[model samples]
Target chain A: MIDKRVGDPAQAVADVKDGDTVLIGGFGEAGSPIELIHALIDQGARDLVVASNNTGNGQVGLAALIAAGRVRKMICSYPRSSNSRVFPELYRKGQIELELVPQGTLAERIRAGGAGVPAFFTPSSVGTVLAEGKEVREFEGRPYVMERWLRADFALVKAELGDRLGNLTYNKTARNFGPIMCMAARTAIVQVSRIVEPGGIDPEVVVTPGVFVKRIVEVANAAHESVLVAQGVTYP
Target chain B: MTAELIHAGLTRDEMARRAARDIPDGAYVNLGIGIPELVAAHIPPGREVIYHTENGVMGFGPPPPEGEEDPELINAGKKPITLLPGASFFHHADSFAMIRGGHIDFCILGAMQVARNGDLANWSTGAPGAIPAVGGAMDLVAGAGRIVVITEHCAKDGSPKLVDACTYPLTGRGVVARVFTDLAVVDVTSEGFVLREIAPGVDLDTVRRLTGAPLLAAAGIKTIEP
Candidate 1:
């Protein structure tokens, strides 16, 4: 029987260990898995290296996790936004590390990791500072720099719908990074707004096949990150 | 025009409208954050341009009505937006493939400085204490077919932005094709900065004084009207 359902966020994230690399699915607040992140904070994993598009805004989701002093490093394209106050302070104080990658290169690295390719060449950062330490080669006289694939021990994702067997579908632009992160991680822990039976979700409409996801938790009403930030809410 | 713009050149909206007129119909376009974003509202009425945001959406419409913003349905800027009838969503890998694979026709961007050789430097100043955050600027410049830049003619301190060489770190080498500034419309060619048009009430000598490099007047230059 291949049931991947778990009781709650805590149970879904219970196995995350210290010093693990975690891929968090989101572009700003769109597909951020807030409940699962809070549960991971409760689970007390430390010294984690997180990769996402942006550090969380205000002090609620990813920011709260960083505020609690859990993350040791962040690998992302952008780390600053209008309300992003937490990471900059810690980063300037030399409390954390940052590896800045170009946005498209970051996406391609994740895609390459899941697709079983080891490395790829891209022209995105060919002559910029980001390409300084990389190996550059020419194809038909145009230069490209090589970037390695990025994989993680765990990935936390938010989805619109899922089944007990772990097939997932996402909502609109919130779907960014969820499907790819699922493929790039060893165990993908997903919090979905609704869960259905195995046959309820049409096979053609499944964005992520059950083979990639490992655990599923039903979070009937997920809180929007911006709303929580607007209300001045901070997680424990 | 305001007193400041009267002395300087065109207004920001006017610069956007001037750049909007050059885009061809049925082109797929990507607009960068500030002044380039204004190009969307001023796109010529007869043209049908499709918008692509780096996050994962295409054919997006204007901002949704106030209070109807959905956090899940947003642009690359993370601001709320509405999807047109043919709007489509994909993952990040596919979205970037559309950009890096040379599928997007045009990309308009905001610039901090652009050199005579078309080297762009908008991402960072390499300042010691600055927290550098480069979202997708490099990829768009490197991959998009024709790169257009829209910016103020000068920096805040009245320093020239179109320079002989970029002192700040480069975003992409030899990538910018054309630049639309408050004072003039200029093209970066093998010969250097060639003036295609000058703003109304602005003289060639004022533009010559403001520019950091040698300027040449195109044979058939026209005055720009907002």
Candidate 2:
């Protein structure tokens, strides 16, 4: 009888305010909480700092939010894609800021946040320009760059299926950052394809327990990026 | 010996095939973008090399069918890919843990420049508007059991890529194990760049001159079949 379902996607993100840092889960088109992102875009939150992988592909997801001038900054690995032009255009004009992190380092930082670790040493950026000005220490004769945790105010994620209590399951590689983001954020809102009773999802199959999830919004026929690729369109 | 024209060296695909030959059977390998990605195509048939894409895909298959492209199944590069039998996906953190934990056996990467002491620099040239995207190159080099660099012998202006020391930002220090270039296969050892195999039609002297560092030919140097 436990249900975390909100009235709708907009309602799911109603608490977001300007200048709040939000973490979005995905790897390009996979696992992006598009409906929730669209809700935030429509909700008119401005000057928001968003952290994600690849800053969304084209105008299909987070790029649309960026196009609306809602995002003030982005912390991600790769922000360039063949179909994505909004970010590059905005970035070049000095309209938006970027804090680029190597993908593995980014993931570890978020994991560290969720695990309550203050900071961790990583070799990913040890000798690269990204390592400049950071604390560096040698571990067993190998230098490791010090990386801090990246906790977020809110985390928006997408999943293939979820129960009323918020136990989530994912489809294919779309599961990329969903679970970790759920743990790293103060409040985790999920957009899912289906909502079932508690027993609907197999106990062994739940990748993210409901404890980390705060709200669930059902989104049917969600616009995944495959739809864009099928049209043979390259740019936004 | 019949002397030939200056070496045209091997093609990119040929360089990729040479890099592929270095992967051991049944090893879990992560291929970096560009030259390293081509290694997947040249992996010998029946070889059990499990390809792991940093975006959370493991046990990779060939590219997806023309019209059957699924965005959900794309690799870290955002390109459509097919999943081999038994392929599975996990959270991004878990994927990286596998990488940073040294679970991946081998990783093939493309280099902008390599120092004589096995230092690697490929992520950024510090060029304006160059994207500066360093997806997972550093993590692989820092974590994988072995790192192989595959690239052309020289820059577009014909400057040597394998140098006495790298001027570009280092992606890793003393990490590269092998270098497969258009002209030869070289090993990065304590003694510096040692020429292992010269491309067909390439003389040992040309290989030595083209290499920015000191090149020592192995006692029994083999010819790289084009």
Candidate 3:
């Protein structure tokens, strides 16, 4: 059951302890839980093991932790570009540990963890470096690679809208890593722009149900500044 | 009055060269998997185009030499890739910021189908045996400044992949800017789908017969040279 209460992002994030594994939701900057991120930064959480689709942007997302010397290790599919300079410098100096997973397999591993599946076989990384040191098996005349499940101590997510029940609806690209991480963590904390009463949202629109979410905190707008920066920029 | 050439049989390398020609200098581009991957090999020497991979490297170079593969440096497919000089690495979040935030100039993607209205349905074919993974195609299509589709003219079953509308799940609605196929170069325009260039040695009527959708001829449609 979801505990719906008005709370501070900083205080809620203070629940995280040092050396805990945290799953951060975002496909880049789209669905990042900035409020919680700021809260964690303000609290100066340390020695974290973060699992996420990608490292957050340098100034804003998970990079903030890296910048603040909090995160000790990161398990992610991609970890370059936003904090390029800081990442390499940290790795070269042995300040942080990094593990890279194939994009598809990483997503699936998180999904498998959330679904209560211990492991799954996929051909995505078969016969490649991604398969190195991983358990391999042949299924139906083709080789399949094994990926272990990933479950974090805390899952941080952002939603466009939510309810007191903790149901979530993500907008556009924000939907990428939010729902999967909600299931792949011991405790899920969500920051939403709007929170309504229970049953206010249609079941079909609830991508992450309250059963998967443990807490919901409401904010006014999550992407307002990022949207302002993104306006008029043409992507190819 | 002579018959116009449509799509012609060409080697994958030749097709890559044809696609690379359309890219402008210094454009930030994402090359999708399969034949589209070959485009990187054909980038003209000294022309700078930053390659952004969803797995979080920018200013990426070509594949690394044998035995030099870095386990830490990989593309979205998990294949090891080399980083060029001045290359930067960052969190996966920032790489996607480049994509969803519109920092990328072009996204050259492989497609299963491209509709006349420019809808792209590339991630899933809805085939019973095909593995369905949408990946980053939706974000790439919706966020890129220009969407360039690279694929064969038809599927193995002989069905035209470019059509009046897509039957498969859409990666993005009406986001395709242009399509580069083995046969021709087609532009998705508000006026409709225009056949701007045909493959060498192929005729217009042959392309017309192969296409399932209505074909509009751009004013200066001509044969694309290798």
Candidate 4:
């Protein structure tokens, strides 16, 4: 039996070293690994290139991580959220760099990376500024811009349930980038609400199989930035 | 002081309703933010249209009941939403795959400007202070089978939004099929912008005068359904 369970959040993310590209999965605040993100912050990895759908909202999770001066750059679609302030301030002051990909392109790049595709042409941002200096080709008489694959050193994802072997299930929209992130990274560390045995989950419902997952961290109460904002939670 | 008259067009909800009429039954539609989002409320009962939100959800139903809003469950614009019975959610990559893969039948998006050649520019004005937020408009416009642009007829400063060329950043070129302005419904054909309908109480002369391009009246003028 290949058990991928880790003792705690610290151990789960202990392998993520400085200067590694980390793919943190989430859309807005849904499906974000807040506890593991906090643990990563405590781990104090520096000069990391963080790729995500959004930066951080409120002052928790990714935003807090950025505030702590951990991330050196971010590759994302939408970096701003309702309560997000840290990224903007750092972005303007030239402390961090940004590679803004269209939301669909970002997701597709990750998906392509996981499927072992090195590059693919897409029509998403053909004529926009995002397509500048990229290879453009005519496929079936329609123009498509070539997008390279995006892989991460490690991916921190949030799942609703996980078996010891790392078969993961997810919550609603919270599953936003979890499944794809697991496949696009070398080491996938999932934060689950509950941990069960290998045979605990029905084979049919396993959204992300254990083969892609490297570690599973059980965090019963996964804090979300959206929930915190709803509850009027903030930080100075 | 002499009294002056002002011209106004359909309300936001009315524009949404007009756009909804074009959607066929069982169409997998993606509604962009702003006026397009209102189409969900006006989706005429009995139409089995499945709504897709890019934040990773399909089969949007209604606004969730008060106090039942789930923070984790939200639309692309980050607003809480309700899910229909058969609604499914997935990761970001899958959501975009559904979009770029051409699974969506139609897309109704809000725009800042649309060109006579069907070019769309809604994401940014490229102004110094304007936030450059292009979520999924480019992907939907480029991949959806057809694109319907719903927007106010003109900017608040009295500049027309439907122009010969877009002055803002282009989201996609030659992607828009139809444009539903507050005052008129126009189709973007190879010929040019053809006026299809005029808002109630509005005249063809008034619409022609306000349009920035050479507008041709359609053979049949349809009513702007509220």
lDDT of 2 by residue, A17-132 (tens): 89998999988888888778888888888999999988666666688889889999999888887777789888888899999998898998888888899899987878778899
Give Cα distance to truth, residue B179, candidate 2, Å: 0.8
| Models sorted by TM-score, best on top | 1, 4, 2, 3
Question: How high is each candidate's interface RMSD, in Å?
Answer: 0.7, 1.3, 13.6, 1.4
Global lDDT of each candidate: 0.93, 0.86, 0.74, 0.87
Worst 10 residues of 3 chain A by lDDT: A227-236
TM-score of 1: 0.98
- Highest DockQ model number: 1
Candidate 2 Cα misplacement greater than 4 A, ranges: A226-236, B1-6
Per-prediction TM-score, chain B alone? 0.96, 0.94, 0.92, 0.94
DockQ of each: 0.88, 0.73, 0.04, 0.72
Against the true structure, what is model 1's DockQ? 0.88
Between candidates 2 and 3, which one is better according to TM-score?
Answer: 2
Q: What is the lDDT of residue A83 in candidate 2?
A: 75
Considering lDDT, which of the candidate structures 1 and 4 is the better prediction for this target?
1
Better of 2 and 4 by TM-score: 4
Fnat of each prediction, in sequence: 0.88, 0.79, 0.00, 0.74
Reference-based lDDT, residue B14, model 2: 91
Query: Candidate 1: which stretches are off by over 4 Å?
Result: B1-6
Q: Could you tell me the lDDT of residue B215 within candidate 4? A: 91
Ranked by TM-score, the better of candidates 1 and 4 is: 1
Cα lDDT of model 2 by residue, B1-226, tens digit:
1111345688899999888888889999998888888988897787889999998988988897798888788887778899888998888888988898999999988899999899999877877766667778888888989999999888876778999999887888899999999899999999999999988877888888778999988899999875
**Order of all candidates by DockQ, from best down to worst?**
1, 2, 4, 3
